[model samples]
Target chain A: DTAVSQTPKYLVTQMGNDKSIKCEQNLGHDTMYWYKQDSKKFLKIMFSYNNKELIINETVPNRFSPKSPDKAHLNLHINSLELGDSAVYFCASSQAFTGIGEAFFGQGTRLTVV
Target chain B: SQQGEEDPQALSIQEGENATMNCSYKTSINNLQWYRQNSGRGLVHLILIRSNEREKHSGRLRVTLDTSKKSSSLLITASRAADTASYFCATGGGTSGSRLTFGEGTQLTVNP
Candidate 1:
């Protein structure tokens, strides 16, 4: 079984179009995160949810919104997507909110906004 | 802002040679982790070194941490072509929540 999985492994859309990426983890974790990897392979944290509650929100643009319906799922929705939104998005889950535990990451979704 | 910065944005080496990558972070951390990412794939955890530890080894990979210097290094011995991937250093810190700040990543290419 895949510990972490994200849907729409690849997304291609025009600028201004909205899209959503779904992430789910079966690792029975309490914390989940969304990270973005740019063209330079720089990984940046966008949001974090613990037990379905928002815990960390970075300096990402307002167009990106993350919603966690439950502890097992964290979904990212992008509104008015721009060219800068093109990047690979990864979903990860950890056992706790503490930094001690290792996180399980999904295969990642590559988004391309033209 | 990125908490960690990895040295040598790119490295190339032949098989059987050793590869070393350095990372420096800005803040105090509870633990530091190294991850490897193959092209078009997600990041995979390689090893973790806590703030209290100075060195750790797993197979051909070795990791060292210096909290006073706020730096860490990952050494891979007997490199193989399959080891061609990007290596990233992430710092785990924050008072209440678990947040890992990742470096830009070092691209290592091991030629057979």
Candidate 2:
């Protein structure tokens, strides 16, 4: 079984459009995160949730919103996506809010904004 | 701002050779972790070393952490073409307390 999975491995949409990427983890982890990887392969954390509570929200644009219905699932929704949003999105999960544990990551969703 | 910075942005080596990548961080950390990502794939956890620990080994991968210098290195022994991927060093636990920040990965290409 896939420990962590994200839907729509590839996404292509025009600018100003709205899109959502869903992520789920079956590792029974309490903390989930959303990361953005740019063309240069720089990974930046966007949001983090622990036990369905928002814990860390980086300086990401307000257009990006993360929703966690349960501890095992965290989804990202983008409103009025811009061209600069074209990048790969990764979902990860850890056993706890502490960063000492290893994280399991999803295959990643490559979003291309035209 | 990234907490960690990896040296030698890219490295190319022939199969059976060893590959080494270094990472330096700005702040104190509770632990350091290394991850590998193949093209078009997500980052996979390779190994992790705590602040109290100095070295860790997992199969062909060796990780060393120096908290005093706030740096770490990952060494791959007898690398294979299949091991070609981008390696990233991440530092965890700082002022934010819960952030796991990653460095700009080092692209390693092991040619056969």
TM-score of chain B of each: 0.96, 0.97
Which lDDT value does model 2 have at B99? 71
> In candidate 2, residue B28 scores what lDDT?
81
For B32-111, candidate 1 gives per-residue lDDT tens digits of 99999999999999998888899999999999999889899999999999999999998886532479889989999999
Q: Model 1, stretches more than 4 Å misplaced? A: B94-97
Residue pairs with colliding backbones in model 1 are none
Model 2 TM-score (2 dp): 0.98
Report the lDDT tens digits of candidate 2 across residue range A39-104: 999999999999999998999999999999999999999999899999999999999577558999
Interface RMSD of each: 1.4, 1.1
What docking grade applies to model 1? medium
DockQ of 1: 0.74
Task: Give all TM-scores, in the order shown.
Answer: 0.97, 0.98
